[model samples]
Target: MDRGGLVVELGPGAGGTTRAILDALPPDGRLLSIELNPHLHRLVEAIPDRRLIAHRGSACELPAVLAAHGFAAADAVVSGIPFSTMPRAVGARTAAAIAECLAADGRFVAYQASARVAELCSPHLGTPRVDTELLNFPPMRVFRWERTGG
Candidate 1:
């Protein structure tokens, strides 16, 4: 995979996707990851990648967090957050943050087990494009959202 621009990953639990992102990024590309869980943060930190910076923080604070790291906007925001398990308020805040941090053309990709894309993101995201990934455990779906000047 060819790394294109600045990439921000939210809730990269266990670093599975973080490793993949590191491999996909170009030498000069940047990868900023936010993990709310302390254990998950430590796990991802173990991966050796100069381009990867793992932050033990909440996704709801993404804009400030990314800006503090010198990132004005991200080209892509990937999330493995457990949206289905989170309360509506928590998920709404996270979705709002993700939308805020993304560039106009940036893609927000979220991995989920259920097909409740609209229900989980409609409060923050405009309209999402859903794609199913049967290969994932429990047959998950990937929701890709683009910011529409909200």
Candidate 2:
């Protein structure tokens, strides 16, 4: 993570990943956490971090969300959304928005129980490098993609 980078975290859920991101982020860095559930958004908002902006909204609104915060692009975008469970059209739009809003060479990392995210995002962001965590019950796949070319 860059010293003053901008990061967007989707589906922060209980905020476990949000806390980890804050711990690693430099004090000057900014974190935008977008969670669809109102209840989960409140939980993330309760995390007392000035650098954290907890937004309650859909990931499909990512570009607007960034603009609303005066962020032109993000250094990284990390997502925990259940892509496999979302409608294909919505997932495709969300993936495209993420690719469009990332800074050149920015990275996108998503942890999921299925490969559906890869199918939706690969066209816009290119192929991802996948890693599996066996420690997690039922296991989880981590898909990472880096922006390249134009």
Candidate 3:
């Protein structure tokens, strides 16, 4: 959150947001992208950046993934997963992982078409700061959840 040392992006489909996050990183910054789909994972992996680690994994495994990458926690996490369409149990598990894997001052950010993530993530990620982006084709909502006393 504060200048970004290690960033994690969940479900980086086609690398659109990946490019944005990579560009925002400082020289010492690194981004770990977790994409489940083989095709989309390959697309993100094709991006030529020394700082990007495109992994074929699910967000539910974030703790293990980060540990495998030699990171205890992330500075910030960005998710593109559509929690609204996913089963509540699955979404809760992934959301919990995001919270647990975040550093003390870490942030959990999500860009979703619906507001479902606000309810799904708040219990773990604390209060959310939300904004609407009407510029997109279907107008998506952006939610940033920061860590607080849990």
Candidate 4:
């Protein structure tokens, strides 16, 4: 992130990524984390940080969530949502919402166990750079895309 820019995180399962993002953010920066599961949302809300706004909602409502939080656009978005397991229509909507809410030149990064995310987001964000993290248990695919010119 760019010191004081805004970042949105999708599906912060247990708040591990939420804490990591908060640690990297500057005091003036903002992090809006959306977690659909109430149990996980509480875990994220427990993080004692002024810059963090943990909201319990579905990732498909990214644009609305950002707007409700008074965020015009996000500098970046990090996702841990299981795109491979979600219904195809839901995944498509979430991907479209992510693309619409990001700032020009903003980046979207998805950590997934499969390439389903890339398949779903390609139409909106273009092709993403794909990499595999061998260290993560069962390995994981990292897909990244950067929006240009809004």
**What C-alpha lDDT does candidate 3 achieve relative to the native structure?**
0.89
Stretch of 10 with least lDDT, candidate 4: 1-10
Which candidate, 1 or 2, has the higher lDDT? 2
Candidate 1 runs further than 4 Å off: 1-4, 147-150
Residues forming the 10-long window of minimal summed lDDT in candidate 3:
141-150
lDDT of 1 by residue, 60-112 (tens): 89989998998889888888888877776887787777767788777788888
> Residue by residue across 1-150, what tens digits does model 4's lDDT show?
657899899999899989898888988999999999999899999999999999999999988898898889999999999999999999999999998998998999999999999999998888899999999998999999987785
Total colliding residue pairs, candidate 1: 0
| CA lDDT of every candidate | 0.82, 0.94, 0.89, 0.92
The prediction achieving the highest lDDT against the true structure is 2
**Candidates' RMSD to native:** 2.4, 1.2, 1.8, 1.0
Off by over 4 Å in 4: none
Deviation of model 4 at 134, angstroms: 0.8
For 1-150, candidate 3 gives per-residue lDDT tens digits of: 335489999999999999999887886789999998999999999999998998998889999999999999998899999899988898989988988889887778899998888887888766899999999978889998776533
Q: What lDDT score is found at residue 27 in candidate 2?
A: 88
Candidate 3 stretches greater than 4 Å from native: 1-4, 148-150
Candidate 2 residue 136 C-alpha distance from true site, Å: 1.3
TM-score for candidate 4, please give it: 0.96
